[model samples]
Target chain A: MSAVWSITKKELVSYFTSPIAYIVIAIFILLSGFFFYSLVWWFNTQAMQMAQNPYYFQQININQMVFAPLFHNLSIILLLMLPVVSMRLFSEEKKMGTEELLFTSPVSVIQIILGKYLAALIVLLAMLVLSAIPTIFTFVHGNPEPVPYLLGYLGLFLLGAAFLALGIFWSALTENQIVSAVLTFGTLLLFWVLSWAAYSARGLWQDVLNYLSFFEHFDGMTKGILDTSDLVYYLSFAFFGLFLTHSVIQFRRWR
Target chain B: MIETEQLTKKYGDLVAIQNLSFRVEEGRIWGLLGPNAAGKTTTMRILTGYLPATSGRASVAGYDVFEQAEAVKQSIGYLPETVPLYPEMTVESYLGFVAEIKKVPAARKKAAVDRAVQIAGLQSVRKRLIRNISRGYKQRTGIAQALIHNPRVVILDEPTIGLDPAQIKEIRDLIKSLKGEHTVMLSTHILAEVKEVCDGVVIINEGKLMASGSLEELARSFSQNDGVYLKLDRADGEVLNLFRQLPGLKEAALDGAEIRLEWPWGQDLRTQVLKLCLDKRLEIREMRSLAMNIEELYLRIVSGGMEQ
Candidate 1:
């Protein structure tokens, strides 16, 4: 356990000691703030116009206007940014030859992979915390639903954990950080876009696909529903990716 | 002690090493001598548990390299040809990471890093980032990372390959200082390093062991006899011819005013040569026996007598 903690702390320190952590956080917050401000401003203007109307129009559906799109946009922003933050987790070490140093040590392959994965997870968590700043507007300026906000964050955390694990696996497969970043971005894009593809298609098979869609589950979190199945799905995704990463590193030892 | 029985490594159709069998007894520094691409790094990698052999068993410190690789890795500290370091990390932080991964206790980790830094003469640069340090300092950092855990066996591959003469001497001396407490297996093309620091030398060529023994034993086995050089005042062909025809002299060559005579066995031919020179009235400036140096003997064995 000390070995794992040692590697985790070392990786975490490396993340903060360089400009990468701050740069990634800056970009993530900047993009997320731009999207959040635009959405909330447009929705708040429409609500103001509805209040001034001579005829009532169901009070402009303010709850969905504030929480529903916030959840959706937050998920998309995280999907785009998490891959960039996680791309260097193992790829840089493999490129720099430090992978051999780690492999030759007495620590098992499990400890090394898990340590690096957890550190990247922590960085993603920090990004999640930063994303909450824009979400604070929903509570102060509009009708606040703390339940949905907290649950949506739980969903975002789980989703980002899953993506981070896959990103780590991709990073381990190559020595080039750009290749890892691009591949991870491509994989996340597929999952993000496929959720809508399944939602649009109308068939029995499509219904099954929509249920499997990442957004289908993430949408529940936006509504403040703690679905056990979505939790299982995201957890399994993270677990399997990490499992494959462990096996890949072990296979590299024999070769 | 370390032992490998027919350890082999094959990458696709290319065989890096085949049937490499050797042993290093406890408390000795063994040199793995080979030219480039002769499987020195491959052999070290197998022993370090970085790569598994295609067929055969390697046991280090009584643990099988394949079956008990974790134990083997615990016992061995390996410095590869290209030392992998985190450029962003300071020398102290890097060594601390190594000690941690190698399972040095937390209380002792600081002392372990300090000891390795001291041994590699890296105290002055301990706080500097690895990327900013000199190449020699980087190489020393590599050594320090490997030695941080105080493993029973230390393996270095081409430890002094890219260093300047001074750095090379410093690293060689560092390896020399590690003689008794640790069993070291260092591979290098510098034959003189083998003679200076190694207790036994293992020579490999074309992925096979050409010879394995101490320097003197190897020289004695391959060289027919120690050659004798005689610098004479007279440089006549007739004098060289007469010296070649003397009893117990197997061969003789003349270069300028010097004559080199080979004797197959240790016969007291110096008296005969002196008497012949006196009778011929030729002045002898210098006469000394020249034993074959380690380089020539190593080349002769590895190349099977072919030389440029």
Candidate 2:
């Protein structure tokens, strides 16, 4: 609908025109390049040492040994950067009082949430594309399976979508951008680190906590396994975040 | 048209508006006058579909505010107290976005934005970012954004509250120009604005309606008698005594060179008072009817000096 497009375009314009987008992209690419270069360099040195012995039984596939770890490291980098990128989605609107125009407009609340969340998704997509430069060098310099790297990228995209949605949820809950960013980071960190606590637990509780961890599925996708359950988990997680955001905005109308 | 029946909005334990009701007929400029904390904005928010009322029913442009909110929103343009705007956007782009969200068709969006910019007199600063414009221009941009949709009903909350005198007059004239084509309701604490621009007014205080009628009707309903003021060159005790003899004279008081007298309701003692001054050889310096204006009526009503 035109209403959603209008808001989405406006939000995208705001994001790119300011220095926030440029700074976030710059930082994400810089960190991702460092990790990628280090991972590939380390993988090469390990491969060379193994070449010294022709009787080595285990094979070192460059995709898993190098590019998979690169994807995993870049996901961690996105975890730190995406929250800041999405922090202004609704918090800035509240700070600027533009929420009044939004609420009074004929546009539905879901359209607004979707529009803003999509714009953040676009920003993350841009970061992913730009950061893929170093990975492209991996293909030119060495033979890495394309499907595995693509799967890792897909997994990162899904995780980024869910993280950005949750960031927007936090942004809608407050008018302070820093508070939104901080809270988003805290919540996402809990999901990323929850698997660590599973190690100390036993039986069903451990399995439940491990399954709840976002990386549990992200790790599976990074290894080139396209599981439907993992895809459903990430999609449903993003939907639940979006649903809560829509409800928060609707509830404010009653106040 | 806009109508409400016993509309009430409560913020938890505090009642923002209580059992308030009023109507805005088609294509008329109406004023909602109240002091600070009088729930003017709260009422406007409900009508604009920005906030839901706690109780009772309200409708805008024939659509229920709560049930048919999307329809109501599509038919109304709202300018809030804070003048909601994206400071980063240009005036032209901001109006364009408003037009788009208000569902103006693709082919007509440019024309709609241009019309709104012209109506708000924002042509000179159409390309300027909202953050860089002056306060008056920003206010006009707010009005332009509200009117871009060309809704039948437009609600502006304190459109001239923080503007300079020149800006205030300009904005008032802009609102007055919409008398016949667009139904407008502007809330303000300035009584003179209502008298100059509004065809009818709804005065409230502490979230309750004090009076709702045209200027003359409200004044007449609050006053016991019509009043007049006369300044005579020789306004001595004898001059006051001569004026008291006029027919329909209810009460007469002389203070310095000014003599203000009250007469029976709907009585025009102007000719009689003039004839008496001519007969007594009293030179009249200044003479004007001091019919109870909106200022006194509002003070009297809000202060509970008049019976509701």
Candidate 3:
């Protein structure tokens, strides 16, 4: 456990020492802030126009009007940005020859992998925390339900973790950071469009594609529905990605 | 402290190291001598548990490299051919991280780092970022990282490879100083390095072990037939004939007032030649017996002059 923390500390220090952490966090905030501002603007315009109608105005819940769409937009932004955060985790180690040192140390492979994964997750968590600052305005000015709003953030975090795990798997495949980032983006994009493909399909194929799609599992969480099935899907996706990464690293040693 | 038996590694069809075997007793310095692509790096990687062998057994500090890898890793410290370092880390922090992972107790981590820093002469650059330091200092920092845990066996692959002469000397001295406390195995293609620092040598070429023994044992075994150089004031053809007439003198040739003689090993012909010189009234200016240095021994063994 101490070995895992040692690797995590070293990785965190490296991320901050370089410009990568600050740049990624800054870009995420800028983009999420833009999305939040535009969504709130649209929500205000609709709320004002519907003021004369009692029934429609009563249905104008801030949770549905502003926060839901914002959470969905934040997930897209995370999908685009988390790859950059995870691209260098393993690629830089192989390129710089530091993998030899890590493997030859007393630590196990699982420990090293978890340490790096946790560091990237911490960076993801920081971005989520900073982006929440804009959401705090909704709580102060309007009466948005706190439970569903927090659940949306939880959904975003799980989705981001799943993205990071796949990114880490790609990073372990090659020594070039650009290659790792592009491959992660391409694979995530494919997973994103699986549900679109499911729309044209029929029967069991549609059900399978919908189940495998990253979009389906995240939908319930944004609506404040705590389904065990969605939780299982995200956690299993992350575990499978980490398992593949471990196999890749272990295979290289024998080869 | 370290031993390998029939250690073999293959990548698909190409064999990196084949049936290689050697040993390093406790408190001794052994050199793995081979030229480029001689599987020196492959052998070191296998013994360090960074790579597994296809077939064979290896152990470090009484722990099998494959079966008990964690124990073996904890007991040995290795510096790969390329010094692995994080450029963003300070020398001090890098050693501290290594100590932590190497399982040095929390209370003693700082002391271990300090001891390694002092031993590797890294005090001057301990606080500086690794990328900002010189190459020599970076190499020393790599050495410091390896020693921070104070393991029983320290394996370094080409430790002095890219340093200047003075830096090489300093690194060599540091390696030599690890003799009594740590069993050290260093790999190099430079014969002079083996001569200078190593007590024994394991020579390999093309992934095959050519020879392994102490320096003197190798020299003696390969230099069974010795030679002598005689410089005299009057080394005419008649003097050469007189020297050649002595029994057990294999061959004597004259060239410009000098005569060269060859004889079997362990034969002392100096007195007989001196007697002949005195009887012939020849003035001997210089007389010396030629002893084989590491260069000749290494060349002979690597060039296939001696059978495996």
> For this target, which candidate reaches the highest DockQ against the unseen true structure?
3
Return the lDDT, model 2, position A233. Answer: 89
True contacts kept of each: 0.82, 0.82, 0.85
The number of the candidate with the highest TM-score is 2
* Stretches > 4 Å off in candidate 1: A50-63, A137-143, A199-204, B224-290, B305-308
* Candidate 3 lDDT, B178-235, residue by residue in tens: 9999999999998899999999999998888998988877766866667778998877
Evaluated at residue B16, the lDDT of candidate 3 is 86
**Candidates in descending DockQ order:** 3, 2, 1
Off by over 4 Å in 2: B234-281, B305-307
Docking class of 2: medium
**What value does the lDDT take at residue A27 in candidate 1?**
83
Which is the better candidate, 1 or 2, if ranked by TM-score? 2
User: What tens-digit string does per-residue lDDT give for candidate 2 at B190-261?
Assistant: 989998999989888888888887788777776678877888876667767777777779888886668988
Residue A17 in model 1: shift from native, Å?
Answer: 2.9
TM-score, one value per model: 0.88, 0.94, 0.93
Better of 2 and 3 by TM-score: 2
Q: lDDT of all predictions, in order shown? A: 0.84, 0.89, 0.91
What CAPRI grade goes to candidate 3? medium
**Number of clashes recorded per candidate:** 0, 0, 0
What does DockQ come to for candidate 3?
0.79
Worst 10 residues of 3 chain A by lDDT: A58-67
Compare candidates 1 and 2 on lDDT and give the better one: 2
